[model samples]
Target: MTSTDHDTAPADRTAAGTAPAPAAPARRPRRELAAATVGSVVEAYDWTIYGILAPYFAEQLFPGSSPTAKLLAAYLGFALGFLVRPLGSVLIGRLTDTRGRRYGLTLTVSLIAVGSLLLAVVPGYASIGLAAPLLVVAARLVQGLSVGAENPSVAAYVTETAPGRHRYFYSAVSYGGVVLGSALSFIVLSVLLGVFGESGIENGAWRYGFLFGALLGLTALWIRRGAQESAVFTAAAPGADPAPGPDGAPGKPGGTGGTGPAGAKRAKAPSPWPVLRAHLRRLTVVFAITSGATTAFYFVTVDFPSYAEGTGAATKEESSAALLLGMVALLLAMLGGGRVADRFGALPVLRVGFAGLALGTVPLVLAMSSGRVPVQLVPAVLLFLLGLPLAVSNVFAGQLFPPAVRAVAVGLPTAVAISLFGGTFPMLAELLRSAGHNDWVPWWPAITAAAALAASWGVREHPLPGEPHA
Candidate 1:
């Protein structure tokens, strides 16, 4: 209908008795996108600091364990932390659904900071005995839960705020923040390691990394505290005002509320059982895509260094440097992925990423495993193939469902998928390596890539969910 017709039409209905048209979704501001992505960045920082330093500090925290055993214990802690993420997703997801994205986000960041701070100051095994490892486990679990909630909520918020034409692109941009955080986290790590050297790192200097991560978490909390509530959540949440901020001033562009004068009420948050029953297929798709992204991600960043170092294709220092470069390359690729998705389409770009992973994962793994190739070659492989494809993951998930259950839908599946795959793949790869089954490592990520490919295949290449095609 023309603008004039829309304005001249009856407030509630046409004279012919049709219902009033739905309001068009509003264009969101870039500032909000920046706000939401900072949450993801903080999550990456807090989550990865331990992983980056686990090798050197393993003995200090879990003293008297053999080198391999110590690293294994540290990896166990890392994996266990991720194992608890789904529970966090459920609890924190509910908060976002009931309270508002802003509140949930604010709470999530603070929890992450607390986790980091705890890890930063935990006493060594010599001083605290088993308590050191216990503290490590506790801190990791808290960080894991915070990350579990932070990512989906941030993705939902960004996707809801993004312009229709660039929805997928905006969604993918957060992965860029993830890469930035990874890169920055490593830079902090490398600086500390260089300053303190291996013995010093083993002597408790590793704590600096978590301290840095805590600072990052606090900064993100500040940024997010100023962010407005997600437009989609504000529109969908019932018994709540559309405005997300405490001041009742709107920061995001769109919000919906009760019917005017008629006293007609809108829908409330549906119970979990019905919501779960309603979105089973989409949830499965979310799992598959998340599995692919998380598996590939963990392989490249978390597991690859150990695998490469084990093979002696790269020393520890070389592997760390390679990961830093790979993250930078991935950051550039994420930005590029966003633009490409905007121009071509989200599904197609996602498919391409999956395709790259499916075809390239094994070879890339093999290259790193060979101990024959140059150490730097792995970063180039990461840029072009597996790691690069994951840039579209956030938008890829966000495009599937409406906002009312967006956080839960995205969070739950992601939690399950990552809890199953992302959190465990590195440990699994470690097991495979220890067992001398280096050849088998690639198949784990390859299978997930293929699964993601199939999931993306089922999704129609199109505009944002609920949006009309041009």
Candidate 2:
């Protein structure tokens, strides 16, 4: 048969033989989206507050001859948190896939809350000696796991629940929550600095930030408790018949089981490892993209402020204010980027963003080093560039896998990438700067951005089952 005839045969036969099932409604559930966004906010707050407050709290928690050593030790603890993220992704991701999105989100938020509370109350080096840093590391480990699972679960939920036409726009909710949470952390830091002064913050006031994060985590948990499960997940649940796609094929299954021709019984759920192995190339694409994007993210949001302060390009208060302003810019950019992605397609938008990063990072870093540009404008511009690709990154990753393996598939590799590149950024940047190789710092993210730009080419857009391809 001719190519056109071959494609049309199935449609013609299905039209002639039986009535096709109506497509699932692409309704936007406000409550569920709100819960996901709130959870994301708390997750970001809990995870980022550590890095923000580390400089103030480092001396108290770590023993070292020099302030730089203490700060490095504290950042090591931060990296330790990222180290366990993959494990969290696997364990919590499995739970998410098996139990449901809402359940996974609630559990992650609870875990992060416990970690935050632990950080708030943990004894310092002066009080507890060796156990102090150990306890801090322990807290980080817990927070890491929660954060590892949290991002992917939230991404999957938002992707599955959103209307296909506006999926990219809705995807902004994930990063928007992150930007808000990061902005809130800076706001809290500014207030604490105002009230207690730098010396007071170093003395003990930093604990309050973690305490506040714990409180916010509890609030997120309450909100998530009321969240509705993703309808796509429900339709794909084991033993539930798959919905019909536009061409009358069986829709993608979630949780477990295999899809076949319409009306065929689904095969039993296979091992996730096999499923993951089958999709290894897709996972690599997620990893490459995440490596570039998250490295840039952590560099701008977590490390750049401290780097500026250390280099005397900006003072503590100045850097803090600049970072806060940058986060606000990022928040706005995320929404705008999502809209642009929806109109132009996510891959093209991602390519453009990463290309900007790959090309512009060095110039921005040089400008910051030169202390010529306004401190606030530099970070705001840098973060705004980062926000564009980040806006729809999680959604793009979510689309790469079927529902049954979406959480773990997206979570595991993304977590690993963050752990390697994003989590290590602060410590690595500090080390380079300390070694007087500060010139090399910008190249790190620039290289990663270039890699992401290349990987974007490999990422084909996969519309949700029953949704029209973009």
> Which candidate leads the pack in lDDT?
2
| lDDT at position 22, candidate 2 | 54
lDDT of 2 by residue, 170-246 (tens): 78876689888888888898889889999999999999999999999999999887665676665555644445444
TM-score of each: 0.87, 0.87
Relative to the true structure, candidate 1 reaches a TM of 0.87
lDDT of each: 0.73, 0.81
lDDT of 1 by residue, 124-238 (tens): 8989899999999999898888888888887777766666666656776766777777777778878987799888888888888888888888888888777756545554556
Poorly placed runs, candidate 2 (over 4 Å): 1-28, 240-269, 464-470
Candidate 2 residue pairs in backbone clash: none
